[model samples]
Target: MSTAAAHPAVRTRSLGDRRRRTLAWVGVSLLVVLGVFVAGGVAGDAASTTALADRNLGPSAGHPFGTDPLGRDLLARVLAGLRLSLVVGTTAALVSAVIALVLASAAAVFGGVVDRVVSWLVDLFLALPHLVLLILLAFVFGGGTQAAVLAVALTHWPTLTRVLRGRAREIVTSDHVTVSRQLGHGRGWIARHHLAGHLTGHFLVGAVLLFPHAILHEAALSFLGLGVDPGEPSIGVLLAESMRYLSAGAWWLAVLPGLCLLVVVKLVDTIGENTRALLDPRSAHL
Candidate 1:
């Protein structure tokens, strides 16, 4: 082949290689996060134990993440907090994705008034400030894990719903879909056999992308005292409690947990983005 022809092949190979590397990184990040959660769960009450002698200690050989004002191991506390945060975030994301999928699929498959109503709701929700709405909802729900999850689930669906709705509409109007209808396939049959399969990729990508948002929002709500209960060791709660001690030189209490949360969110976002790129037909060949 000529150099011009070879150039495209080389570019394609480079893109594929980059995607593979991204996938590897995503796997490693997920494993690390999971390990933290597992370790935290296993640690149980160990995270909350206090040893006044170690109070206010900074990072050192024995205490890598240091100790809080109450002398609890910051490392253990952070791990536990991370585990709770991940659980809340994952639950909320799953709930939000399910809501989006149902609304989007119904709107696209049924069309007319259903589509109009869903579209209007999406626009209305999108217009509101997400964090404020989440906080309000969390407060109303009584401020706990359920409240936090519900708040995140309710507020995060609009954008994903819009995306799913568009994709579903396209799928329903495609040649194969029309032929299936012409062949006497019922709506339920067509949905089960055609729409579901076609839209799975979109749903997965949207759900993955929603994970980071859910985590961040949950942490914010907890930090604001409208999320998890005060006694719960969630990332937000950890950060909120650390504020009072910060002025007294317990900086590690907040910094370590905050950094861990940030890293987890970034990793999830990266994984979602790369997954979406890999799944896109147009990008797959490139």
Candidate 2:
């Protein structure tokens, strides 16, 4: 059946399927993320599949990606890393979005000293290098999973807030909004009834787009030793470890996890594209 002719649920599922496939890449990423912590806490510490005897061995049923110099199971490590990466990625994205929404909404609805203060803070954040600032914050704050999550989120909110603030500005000028004001509607009513409806689409699309950034930020931080701590199996951290084994001919240590990260980013980009097509009036025909 034609994509357009399929049942609505099926069509939605199709989109979901694509989204899931894309997210599968994220699943792999999260494995690396989880591996660090999971491996540290597991039995025999066998999380990494590559045994000492099997170090640098090529892909096989017993050791698909082969072992690293440290004799950890690379496959297990990669899987675990996926969980960690996802946790950090998802955590950063959610917290960042919440922060952006609260600040943006308050600034837009109140529009006084609050707006200026928030806008100024946003400008300050925007001026800093996001990844660098995140690393510094993570370093200063602490090294727990939650700390890493907050660090990433704090650095991320400025861009989203800027986007949403602009969107709200556009919405506040509309006729319905103006009429709501004239009709003696309260600030809450104007925000909930008129402003929110229009901004939802834009913000959601922005949120999806932010996913890849969040993932990358978390992975990067972990790699830099500022996010997930040692033994925390993030893909970025794994990639960092793999670099050590690269000179010894253990390629899968990096390749598999890196491939997963790349694919997730692309898939997220695709979803954002499709979402754009669906949400943008100008792109609806496409």
Candidate 3:
């Protein structure tokens, strides 16, 4: 009767085995881009982006992706921004994911007094709109990369908590989980070996989905001047700077960088979807 006693690893394997090879390739592409960003950041310069005369120029050998009104090298800024996005996005999502997992696991596994409290907190957060909460959070946390990360973490954790709670509840009733408990497994052991089997994929999938949202949330705050500081080359900051020049002559400053941000989010989303498909084999059929 207790799924919590189940052999979660076996179930997880069954779930994963149904996925096709395409999912692996998609994952690899994401890793490759991540590597390029890390390598490029070490070699790139945020401040060295070109000047006024060179600003707003179209693609050329000397300057690819053209220049912004401030004459900053759009390509270079993009590369540098990529690094910032990757770091900020990953850290924010991971921090939130951990919090969500902890809170949700506690609620689901315990399920009496603690469950009500955590469920209420999760509901309270969900009741508020994400952007409104993020901005308010950004202000309270104070503006910077930390604020952006904290704001995103605060906003993101609730959904993951709910999902984890749901999975925990289901796993609790599963046959393998019940058997595991009867076999004299400790709570920690059950949670780690069994519950973890059913939940890790969910958490990982949620984390991947969280990545694009993290990037977008950071960019949104930066766009509104509440995100990463101006000196840094964030996509949002770049777009904000480009706004003034767009009226004068340059369009690429905002457009190209925006496109780059857009593409990154899109790619992340695709990866998330593929991961979801891999985890949920019925989706592969659909």
**Candidate number achieving the greatest TM-score relative to the actual structure:** 1
Q: For each candidate, what TM-score against the reference?
A: 0.94, 0.78, 0.86
Residue 269, model 1: lDDT of: 85
lDDT of 2 by residue, 1-286 (tens): 8767878978678877765665665566445444544653552346644456655666778767666666776666766766566567777887788788878888888888988998999999999987778878888888657768888788888988998888887777778778889989988988888777887887777777777888887788777777777776678788888787788777788888888777666666666666766567356455
- lDDT of candidate model 1 versus the reference: 0.89
Best-first order by lDDT: 1, 3, 2
Ranking by TM-score: 1, 3, 2
Local accuracy of candidate 3 as per-residue lDDT tens digits, 1-286: 4667576876877666645465675777698668748855763764455577765687778777887666777788887887788789989999999889888778766779998999999999989888999999999988998899989888899988998999888887689878987988866787787677788988998998888999999999999988898888888998888888888767778888888888878888888878887677566577
Q: Which candidate is the best by lDDT?
A: 1
Candidate 1 per-residue lDDT, tens place, 1-286, comes to 8999999999999888987887897788778877978998986687889999888899999989998878888888888888888889889998999999999989988899999999999999999988889988998999988999999999999999999999899989999999999999987887889889988998998998999999999999999999988888888999999998888887888889999999989988877877888788465456
| Model 2 CA deviation exceeding 4 Å by range | 1-50, 281-286
Q: What local lDDT does model 2 show for residue 176?
A: 76
Model 1 — which ten-residue stretch has the worst lDDT? 277-286
Model 3 misplaced stretches (Cα beyond 4 Å): 1-21, 24-28, 46-53, 179-186, 284-286
